[model samples]
Target: MIDDAGSTLTAELSAYHPLWHLKRINWLEGFGASVPEDEPITTRVFLIDTGVHVGHPYLSKAIDAQLAIDFSALPFGLRYVDGINKPIEFDPEILDHLPLSANDKATISQLMQRASGKLCKAPLETALHTAFPSHGTACAGLIGARMPGFFTDPLPSLTDGKPALAVPYWGVDPLSTIIPVSTSLNPTPGQLILALVYALQNQADVIHLPRGISVAWMSDNGEYDNPGLSLKTDQDEAEWEALEALLFAISRTVPIVCAAGNSGENSLAYPANLSLEDKGENGIISVGALSSAGFRSSYSNYGPGLTVVAPSDDATVFNRYQIRINELGRRYRLHDYAGYVGAGLPRVDFSREAILSTDIPGQNGYTGYSPLGYDEDDDTFAHANDPLQGAFTLFGGTSAASSIVAGVVALMTRRAKMKGQILSGPQLKQILRATARGTPADTKADDINGDKASLELLFGSGLVDAGKAVGKIGA
Candidate 1:
């Protein structure tokens, strides 16, 4: 089915675009900034997203072939390629219809039902059908690539009025294995422990979790101080303790990166801030968001726990639009702003305005669904088409921020792999933080508490200089 044009979404999404401000940064004037093809570092990033679409042009280049191996051991029906997985037969509405045997699907479904709270889960079948246009897919696009062999032929022969599947020139195997978990997966205390164990069993180098205790444990009252929302409370303390224990255990193996959270509040999001307590270790990276203006977006939660900031598009206007409502209920559209993007916002800071990366081939259910129209309040409307800019639209949230940081971690790891340097997680975090550049003296400061501060909590480490980070590769 044809989808809405991205141009409209792009127009609406301009303000929220994370790199919106990067466009404003005078990279030419920067002391060390240069748009060079090669950097001191180029690493392999393992993107943990819903699934990536193999058909998009951008991802075709980043797929790492050397690591590709057949993982038919995973459900046999699933196919991989094109920097995305090929769609399979499954109904979007049916959450439990894997072609695997009844017992098998049941087992997987049950596992996901329990774990769904932490991982961003969706039907693998749905991801394939839509070509994965969800937040997870967009994340993968920001990292690695897809190989051409996955696409046997661009022009497959048509049969029964349907295009034939492309044939691969070489036998394709799984690259950077994916262990799918539900986006809604909320792990029980026991389950969280088990899953962490499983992830470690798989030797996952870095675990990217989108949600944590703070946002997950909030209450209906909507107060941050309430024990319900605070991680220190009785209901959440156990979970927090378990997560911390797991983090400590896992840090011994792989580093963990979490989104700082999208809540525009005074405190740092839990777990993200928790990791920042200086464990004297390298197992955690807490990332914040930076706007295109090279400043922190207004909405991102910020505080001391922040390790660094990345290109998490602070806002996607296409995702959320606010309409003004009067006392009489008369309503009119003001400006539709993307959460983090605006004039003077942080830009991608690269020569190419768009960060050239992977793209999902089809629609994941989130976008392209029939629009979620105005709510009872009439103050907002979420046009399904309006929620996305392209199959590869821009989005922001600690979710995007988390993945961006993970990608950088991957690249750093890869660079180290090449240089024969063996650095641990604590070491990496220190290097990244130490190399960070500060905000300029004349740069506009954040208006917090009726006064401006040179170093605001939101955009930590100033603007992330990937080039500088790369330059500091060996250091």
Candidate 2:
């Protein structure tokens, strides 16, 4: 956790690492502001995406499990109001279809029992089987995973007697609360609308949508046009209208931080694109990703709707490293290596540049401990015998960037409440835009369909300046 001295347990970690992304955005400077002690307000950030692994040690304290809602349990095409009235029931028979062990099924049943009602519960084993179990968990961790005070086993540090790794990890806003809302990987328009409604009812201070919907149809010139303008069917048009209405209502109060898709195109996905139409204060905050080298991330989508950019993995730097130690049997024991070197042990580098966050524990999640030996070329590393093997992994994309922005918003909200003032969604958005730093020097304007665009068109206002934004809250 961040203390008064502004130093964390993972402070001595490597300079060339994933955590550097936080420093790039001046996160610590922003966190230094004083919040009112007599009247504290809990900033609740509603994370609408694949359910989080609430049981993860790093995220256990940050998440509010009782308020978590799983819309995936509701049948498709179910109306938003009906889902609220209906109780979500997990069917045991569905587990039978999955190729899981009997023990896994039993554990899932236990989790289901605990998750009954509005309480959100995501079984680690079940999530591991999904396409991306770490998706929501990683995003949540980026927003508010608490820094553990103690470790079960000491981690391997590059320096002798100093406990540090390739990167130290923690949430951007550890004091904020996260409300995990579970949904299918590709949720329908109705399901997304339902999630937004749930967040609004819960009085969420900030809503982070790590995913995006492309409601706009592509034109013959290879550009995404306005939403609901080229819909082919009445049903599609109706769904778009419903989504717009809900967004319009929510934007008036709560800031909806959205990822500017990963399509690498010049167009933003729906809702994120809505930022373009949002001239008011309370509106969508579209976030794009910036590479480690201070440039717009190659995969991040950019256009007029982008509100700001944040530091994210550029897929160039390697964040994952494996080292062999002599103390094989001792748990979490790092050998006192001579100097900072690991006594000439064979080290492995596998993972690429990405944000580090909590993942599903054990071998089920990404960075699983594989027994078949290490494959340096593969993204997943074999931590079978490593003492530093914990519930953490490297993740990237505009989604990660969006989560970081949401965390900043949470901090700003807390700061506002501390000052005995309430900043509306639009006020916060305006502050962020006003305080944002200029775009990176490497960022260049792009020509979209023979039309020259300015840097603002590509990177929105500019990079998000957390310190400036937080300091300006209530001013």
Each prediction's number of clashing residue pairs: 58, 2
| Winning model by lDDT | 2
Number of the top TM-score candidate: 2
Model 2 regions more than 4 Å off: 1-3, 7-16, 34-40, 73-125, 150-167, 216-236, 278-281, 315-352, 362-390, 439-453
Put down candidate 2 lDDT per residue, 1-475, tens digits, no spaces. 2343344323533353557667767787676563454555699999988777777777888888767777665431111232234465555454454334564445445444444234433443445444354678889999988766423244333345454433345787888899888766666455566676667667789999998865544346545434324526644445456566567557767899999988767888877888876444446899998765555665678888789888776532211222322222222133343243454533322123567777766555555533333434343344443344546766789989999999999989888888878777777888888988765463544333343557887688788877889999766
Quality of model 2 by C-alpha lDDT = 0.66
Model 1 residue 216 CA deviation in Å: 6.8
Q: Give the TM-score of candidate 2.
A: 0.72
